[model samples]
Target chain A: MNSVAFVIIAIFTLAAALAAATLPNLMHAALCLVLALLGLASFFFLLGAEFVGLVLVFIYVGAVAVLIVFTILLTGRDSREHRGFNWSGVVIALAVFGCLTWAILKAQSLTIVPPHIRALTVRQIGQVLMAGYVWPLQCVGVLLTAALIGALVLVLEEKR
Target chain B: MTPTLQAFLIVSAGLFSIGLLAALSRRHAIFILIGIEMMLAAANLNFIAFWHFAPPPHPSTGVMIAIFSIAISAAEAAVGLAMVIAVYRHYRTTNVDQFNQLKG
Candidate 1:
């Protein structure tokens, strides 16, 4: 039963992702993208990453999707381009997939460092994130702050 | 293959490939945004798989990264769409053809 559920979720997620990628209608694609994100969150839950799952729903579906919609609404431009899937692109994509699969398989043969498993919890993460990865985390914060400032400038700029 | 971790892995691979193709071949910026979202989900799936199949002794290993990525990607989408809007305002279109102002 659980396997069935996972399969169903996987199918829906992949279908929605494909729709988001290939659908020419921007609004429809965005809606599909939201669905895809929701499906991924559910997958996370099934896999026991409850916090991660909730974050996916809250951040991707709630914040990111909403922002995309808001931007689309603000533009007031009709998405008129009707793009049927290109057979050429399909062939090319398959080739790319084949090559990537081969590469991943080849790499998989190599022995690599296994992930250390001392503990796994939000509390442990909070400790490691602040103690060991503090500088890098701060760097990420600074990068986001810069991005926010850049966005502010761009949005406030004069339009021609 | 039997339906288990392997099946999920294959589906994740397919999803990631679809995302890559969309990002590479699509002309619209919004399509590319969707592609990025798909790719992020693929990574999240990988995290979940490791958590379920070969997780660390602790309870939070791969899951924390997945959660962080989701939050970071949200900020990414926000700034990304804002820039898209600015670009549209500048050139009156979101078509990728006209977006090559820095071509050297």
Candidate 2:
């Protein structure tokens, strides 16, 4: 049952990702990206990282997807079709996948089944974030602030 | 049989490859950014899978890193889109091939 669910979700996610990658319509591509992110969140749920999955949905589907759509609207649509597809990228991507799959198959340790464990709780995550990871947390906070300001500054209109 | 760690790793590899394809082939700047985001998400999946499969007394380390990565990627997407918009304003088009001013 678990493997079955995994296969289904994997297929769905890959399909959505392919659409997002190859769609000619920008709006459709962005929406497909949202679908792909949601599929990823489901994979997180399947892995028992419920908090992480929820956060993924909240941040990715809520904030990031909305931002992408808004940016698409703001940027104004381009009626012209993009140039022909670049086949070299397809070759490179396939080669990378083959290499990664070969490496994964060669790793003897990776075939082990997952051990039963307690599901991670939000409280545990919060406690760790405040205690052991406080410094990194603080750093991320600063980085987010800098990013927010930098994005605004980058888009701000210059005075004549 | 339940999926093994290798299965998860392979899935992520496929995802990462798709992302690479998007980043490499797409002419639009937004598509490239989307591709990068997908790649980051694939890495996050790998981290979570490893954390999940590790033996007892599992550390919250992988979960923590995934959370942080999500935050950072959000910041990255914001900044990247802003740059995209700025570039569009200047160049008046989002086709990446046309931005060859720096080619020497």
Highest TM-score model number:
2
What DockQ does candidate 2 score? 0.84
Residue A42 local lDDT, model 2: 95
TM-scores vs. true structure, each candidate: 0.83, 0.97
Give per-residue CA lDDT, model 2, range A1-160, as digits (tens): 2888999999999999999999888889889999999999999999999999999999999999999988888876672348788899999999999999999999998888779878778888999999999999999999999999999998999577
Candidate 1 has which clashing residue pairs, if any?
Answer: A117-B57, A119-B58, A120-B58, A120-B59, A120-B60, A121-B60
When summed lDDT is taken over every stretch of 10 residues in candidate 1 chain B, the lowest stretch is B1-10
Off by over 4 Å in 1: A82-87, A99-128, B1-3, B55-59, B100-104
Give the Å error, residue B65, model 2: 0.4
lDDT values of the candidates? 0.73, 0.92
Kindly list the interface RMSD, in angstroms, of each predicted candidate in the order they appear: 4.2, 1.0
Best by lDDT: 2
Tens-digit per-residue lDDT, A1-160, candidate 1: 1678878998998898888777777888899989888888888777666667777888777788888888777765846543544466667767876875666556653223334333345676678778766776887788779878877987896755
> Which residue pairs in model 2 clash with each other?
none
